[model samples]
Target: MSALSPSAQRVQAVLDGFGLGHRVVEHEGSTRTSEEAAASVGCDVAQIAKSLIFRGKDSGRPILVIASGVNRVDEKAVGRLIGEKIERADPEFVRASTGYAIGGVPPVGHAVPPLVLIDADLMALPMLWAAAGTPNAVFRLTPEELSRLTGGRIEAVRKG
Candidate 1:
């Protein structure tokens, strides 16, 4: 495996601080989308944990949604749950808030602590694959561990 990039290293440091021994796996290229990650990592699409970022329109704060790769987050539902209006955040906003870029944002490391919400659907899976800061690196974690590590509230946020 190649050396972990600075971004990945930051993610590793955060994971370590959490006392979780999850190992980051660096790949040949960026897994920009859940479908791409699923194909590259040989996992079911549903097992890919997409760390989606949104901006709370009312509060002007970042909102992190850790949803199943195959499921689209329902913005309306999320807004209701969090008691704020929300919209999909732009790349610049995401970068400013999360430090990591869109495709490579990790669930644990962020520039600021956003209101994190984990899809309850993700909890049904045994393991989840998520980006490890860099676009080319990733890591695996159990749903329960992910919830605990991020202090995410589990909710049904998928769009029908």
Candidate 2:
């Protein structure tokens, strides 16, 4: 197995915290986009769970939303749910809050616990894949397991 990046290591630690076992695969090229990640992981685009960070309007807290690769986050609905407008967190804010880069941010393992929302659309897939804290690495898990591990709420945060 190849060595994990610092962020990947942190993600692994979080997985360990939940006693979840996962297989990590590292690829040679960029997996920043859904197409790239799907090709690298040999899976359908819908199976990829894209992790997105947003700033909460109410608490000014960081919110992590795990959405399906094929869907887009419904910012307006999300904002309404949080009682404020939702904006994508900038790279600096993302890194500062999650301790991970934009494309490599995982659903778990942040510097602090973030308000997490798991897109219900992702749960339609039997198995979902997500970044393992690095652009070249990914891990697979069930949506229920991911929700349990991250303590995230199941919501329709994404729109088809």
Residue 43 shift from truth in candidate 1, angstroms: 0.7
Q: Count the backbone clashes (under 3 Å) in each candidate.
A: 0, 0
**Worst lDDT 10-window in candidate 2:** 17-26
Instruction: Write model 1 residue lDDT over 59-80, tens digit each, in one string.
Output: 8899999999999999999999
Question: Candidate 1's error at 47, in angstroms?
Answer: 0.2
The lDDT for every candidate, in the order shown, is 0.92, 0.84
- TM-score for candidate 2, please give it: 0.93
